[model samples]
Target chain A: MGITGLFLISFLMVHCFLNSLIFINDGGETFNLGAEFMAKNWVIRAMEIVLFGGLLWHIIQAAVLTRENKKARPVAYAASNPSANSKWYSRSMGLLGTILLIFLIIHLRHFWVVSRFTDEITSGKETLFNEMKEVFSQLWVVILYCLAMVSLGYHLLHGFKSAFQTLGWNHVKYNSMIEKIGVIISIVLPVLFAAMPIAIYMGLIK
Target chain B: MSGNMNLTLKVWRQKNKNAEGKLVNYQVKDISPDMSFLEMIDVLNEQLIVKGDEPIAFDHDCREGICGMCSLYINGRPHGPKDRITTCQLHMRSFEDGQTITIEPWRAASFPIVKDLVVDRSAFDRIIASGGYVSVNTGNAQDANSLPIGKEDADLSFAAAACIGCGACVAACKNASAMLFVSAKVSQLALLPQGQPERYLRVHNMVAKMDEEGFGNCTNTGACEAECPKGISLSNIARLNRDFFVAGIASDN
Candidate 1:
C-alpha cells in the first residue's frame, strides 16, 4: 500500500508539473506540445499502464483493509474521543481515498478515455487546452474538481509521510523533516491541480 | 483525601457472548477516595453478594500496573480516567461527588463479551503464539552480556518488552488495531540476537496472523500509546512496519 502510494505521489508531481504548463498563457501551444509528447511517447505510455495497475492494486488493498477494519470492531464504542489521538486527516484516509477514487474516475473519463480509446481528443490537430476549456466550461465539473482536490489534499497530507513511515524510512533526526516535506507536498500538489480548472472557468487561463 | 464520595455507576452487564448487553445502573454510597478503583469495585461486589445478586465480572490480576489482565473502559477511556494507569491502579479520588461513571468492556468483534466487563482476548494470544518469541535451543541459556548489544538498543528493547499483551491498545484504537501490541513483541525480540534467525519470518507470520484474526491496519493514531498502561510508544509500530516492509521485499527472492 505504501509503495503504490509513494508511486502515485511521484506521479502527481510529474502530473502537476505538466498541467502547470498551461499557465504559460501562450494560448495552449506549450501545453499541447507537452501533451503530444506524453501521448506519443512509448515510455510514458508504458508507464501509464503501470500507473493504472498501481491504482487498481491500491484500490483493492484499501477495500480489503477497510473491510478488515470494520470487522475488527463489530460493535462500535459507546463513546470515543478520536480527535485526542490523531489528526482528522490521518484517521480519515480511507474516506479521503474513496473520494479521490471518485475524482479519478471523473478525471479519466474527461481526459484519458478520450485520449486513448478513441481519437476524440484530436490532440495532434487541436490543442488539449481546448479540451480543458470545454470540460471546465461546465460549472458543476469545475466544482467537482475543486471538491475532489480538497479530498486529495487531506489524503496526501496523511499518505505522504505514512508511505515513508511504513517503508521504514523514518529517522529520529530526519522524521520531522520528512513529515514537513510531506505536508508541503500534500498542500502544494492538490492546490495546483485544483487551480487549473478554477482558472480556466474564470478565464484566468485561456 | 479522607472524604468519601457518593456516585452512580453505569456498568455494562451481558450474560454471555450471544446475549444482548446494556448499561445497568447501580449506586454506591460513600466510596472512599483512598481506595483503588478495583477496591471500590470489590466493595460493590460485596454489596451485591450480600443482596444475593450477580456480582459484576471484570478482569484483573495484580493490583499494581504490571499485569495486563484488567481491561475496563471507564468514562470512555480505557483503564479508567487516569493516564498511564490500569484499572487496578486508578484511584477513587479521580472522581467527584455525585459523578456518573460509565464502565464498559473492550469493544471489538475480535473481543466478544464473555460475561460482563471481561471479553475474550484469546485473539491476542493466538497472534502471539503465531510468532512472538525467539527460536531458542533447548540448553543452558547464553550469558546476557555475550550478545554485546548496545545500551540504547537494550533500553528500547526493554521498554518494548514491558508490553503485557493487554488488549487495551486494541480497545483504545478506532480501528481496533493490535499493531502496538504485536510491534512491541516484534521489537523486543527483533532487537535481540536470539531473534535474528527468524526476524523477517516473525513479523511476516505475526502480521499475517493478526490480519487472519481480523485486526485492523495501523493508522498511526497514537491512541494506543496514550491509553497504554506501559506507555508503549508509536515508534515501535514504525519499527514493525519497517521490518515487515523489508521482509516483503527480501522474501520476493
Candidate 2:
C-alpha cells in the first residue's frame, strides 16, 4: 500500500501537469500534443496498466485496514470525541477515498474510456481538449471536479507523510522537513488539478 | 467554598466478556476535591460494597501513574480531562461542583472485556512477546560504560522506554492502531548495541505481530502522543517504521 500510494502520488503529479497544459489556451494545441504523446507512447501505455492495478490495490488495502480497525472494536465507545484527537480528514480517509473513487469513475468515463474505447476523444488533435472543455462547461461537473480535488487534497495531506512513514523513510530532522513538504504537495497538487476545470469553466483559458 | 463538590458518575458496567455493557449512574455526594480520581472511585466502591451491590471493577496498581493500569475515558478524553497525566494523577477538583462525569472503558477491537472498565490487554503482551527484546542477554557481561553510548541516543532510548504498556494510545486512536506503543518498545531496544543483533527482525516481528493481533494501520493521527501519560513522543513511530522498512529488505537470512 505504501509503495502504491507513493506511485499514485507521482501519477497525480504527471496527470495534473498534463491537464495544466490546457492553460496554454492556444485552442488546445499544446494540451492535445501532450495528450497524444501520452496516448501513443508504449511506455506510458504499459505504465497506465500498472497505475490502475496499483490504484485497485491501494483501495483494497484501505478497505481491509478499515475493516480490521472496525472489527477490533466490536463495540463502539459510549461517547467519542475523535475531533479532539486528530483532524476530521485524518479520521475520514474512507470517506475521502470514496469521494475520489466516484470522481475517478466520472473522470475516466469522460476521457479515458472515450479515448481508448472509441475515437470520440482522440479523433483529432484537439479531441481530448475539446472533451475537457465540453465536460467542464457543465456547472455541476465543474463543481464535482472542484469538490473531488478538495477531497484528493485532504487525502494526500495525511497520506503523503503516512506513505513515507510506512516505508520507514524518516530521520528526526528530515522527517519534519518531509512532512512540511508533504503538506505543501498535498495542498498544491490538488489545487493545481482543480484549477483546470474551474479555469476552463470560468473562461479564463478559452 | 470548601473545595468540595457533589457529582454524579456514569460508569460503564459489563458483566463479563460476552455480556452487554452499559453506563450505570451513581451518586457520590460531598466528594472532597483533594481525592485522586481513583480515590474518588474507591469511595464510590466502598459505598457500593456497603449497599450490598456488586462494586464497580477497574484496574489500578501503583496509583502514582507509573503502573499504567488505570485506564478510563473520562468525559471523552483518555485518562480523564487532563494533559500528560494518567487517570491516577487526575484529581476531583478538576471538575465542577455539579458536573456529571461520564466514564467508560478503553474500547477497541484489539482489547476485549474481562469485566467492567477492565479490558484484557494481553494482546499487547502478545505483541511484546513476539519481539520487544534482545535475545543476547540474561547474564551480566559488559561493564557500565563499555559501549560508549551517546547522550542523545540514551535520552531517546529512555524516552521510548518510558511507555507503560498502557492501551491509552489504542483507546485514543480512531483506528485503534498500536503504532505508538509498538514503536516505543521497538525504538528503545533498537537504540542500543545490545539490541543490534535482533534489530531488523525485532521490528519486523513486532510489526507483523501487531498486524496479526487485529490492530489497525496507523493514519498518523498523533492521538497516541497526546494521550500518553508518560508523554511518549510520536517520533518513535517513525523510527519503528524506518526499522521495519529496513528489516523487510535487510533481515533476510
Candidate 3:
C-alpha cells in the first residue's frame, strides 16, 4: 500500500506539473504538441494504465481495511471523543477519499472521455490539449477542478505521511523531515494543479 | 470565607457498561481553592457514599501527570482546561466560585466502559503487548557505554519514550486513531541499537495489534500533540510509518 501510495503521489507531481503548462504562454500549440506526444508515447500510455490500476488497488485496499476496522469493534459507543487521542484527518480519510473518487470520475468525464468521444470544436481524437482548454474555458468546470484539487490536497496531507508510517520507514531522526516533505508535496502539487485552471479561467496565460 | 467556596458539580454517573449514564448534579460546600481536582472529586464521592448513593467511578493513579492513567473529559476539554497536565494534577483553583464543572470519561469506541468514568484501557495494553518491548536477553545489565548511539538519536529516543501509555491520544482523536501512542512506543525502541533485533516485527505486530484493538488510523491532524500531557510529537507517527514500510518490504521479500 505504501509503495502504491507513494507512486501515486509521484504521478500527481508529474501530472500537476504537466497541467501547469497552461500557466505558460502555450498559444494552444504547446499544449497540442504535448498532448500529441503523450498520445503517441507507449511508455506514457503504459504508465496511464498502471496509474489506473494503482488507483483501483488503493481504493479497494482502503475499503477492505476500513471494513475490517469497523468489524473489529462491533459495538459503537453513544459518544466518541476520538479527538482526545488521534488526528482529525486520519479519522476522516474515508470521507475525503470518497469525495476524491467522485471528483476523479468527474475529472475523467470532462477530459478523458470528452477528448475521446466529442468533436464539437475539433475532430474526434483532436488531442487532450484542446479538450483541456475547452474545459478550463467554462467557469463552472474550472471551479469544480479547483475544488477537487483542494480535496486532493487535504487527502494527500494525511495520506502521504500515513503511507510512510504504515510501511514503517519512520525513524525519529528523519521523522520530522519526512512529515515536512509530506506537507510540502501535498500542498505544492495541488496548488500548482489548481493554479493552471485559475490562470486559464482568468485569461492570465492567453 | 476567603478560601472557602461552595461549588456545583455535574458528574457523570453510570452503574455499569450496560447501564445508561447521566450527569447528576451535586452541591459541595466549603471547597478549598488549593484542593487538587481529584481531591475535589474525592470529597464529592465521600459525600455521595455517606448519603447512600453509589459513588462516581473514575480512574486515577499516582495523582501525577506522569502516570497518564487519569482520563477525564472536563467541560469540553480533556484533562480539564489546563494545558499539559493530567486530570489528577489539575487544581480546583482553575475554576471560579459558583462555577458548574461537568466531568465525564474519555469516550471512544475502542475504550469500553468497565464502569462509570472508567473504561477498560487494556486495549492500549494489547497494542503494547504486540511489540512495545525489545528482545534483549535477560542477563547482566549491559554497560551504558556499550552501545555507541549518537547523542542526537539517544535524545530523540528519550523524547519518544516519554509517552506514558495514556489513552489521551485516542480520546483527543476524532477518529480514535492510536497512531501517536503506538508510534511513540515503536520509535523509542526502534531508534536504539539495542532494539535492532526486533525492530521489524515490533512495528508490524504493534500496528497489527493497534488495528485489532479497533483504534482508528492516524489522520495527521496533530490534535494528539496538543492534548498530550507529555507533549509527544507527531513525528513519532511518521517514524512508525517508516518502520512499518520497511517491515512490510522485508516480509514481502
Top DockQ prediction, candidate number: 2
Which candidate order results from sorting by lDDT in descending order?
2, 1, 3
Lowest summed lDDT over 10 consecutive residues: which window, candidate 3 chain B? B138-147
Of the two candidates 1 and 2, the one with more favorable TM-score, higher being better, is 2
Best by TM-score: 2
- Model 1: per-residue Cα lDDT over B147-250, one tens digit each: 68889889989999999887889988888999999999999998887788889999999999998888888777678998898999788988999899889888
Off by over 4 Å in 3: A65-92, A117-127, A161-188, A202-206, B3-8, B98-100, B129-131, B134-150, B192-194, B251-253
Per-residue accuracy of model 3 over A1-206 as CA lDDT, tens digit each: 56778989988877776666666675766766666677668999899999999999989988876775565444444344456544666667788889889988988888777654576434644556556666789998888878888778878888888776666576657778988998999889888888877877787776
Which of the CAPRI classes, incorrect, acceptable, medium or high, describes model 1? Answer: medium
Evaluate residue B189 in candidate 1 and report its C-alpha lDDT on the 0 to 100 scale.
90
Interface RMSD list for the candidates? 1.5, 1.4, 4.5
DockQ of each: 0.55, 0.62, 0.31
How well is each residue in A19-45 modelled by candidate 1, as lDDT tens digits?
A: 999999989889888988998899998
Estimate every model's Cα lDDT from 0 to 1.
0.87, 0.88, 0.79
Interface RMSD of structure candidate 2 (Å): 1.4
Task: Score candidate 3 by DockQ.
Answer: 0.31
The Cα error of candidate 2 at residue A10, in Å, is 0.7
DockQ of 2: 0.62
TM-score of the second chain, cand. 1: 0.96
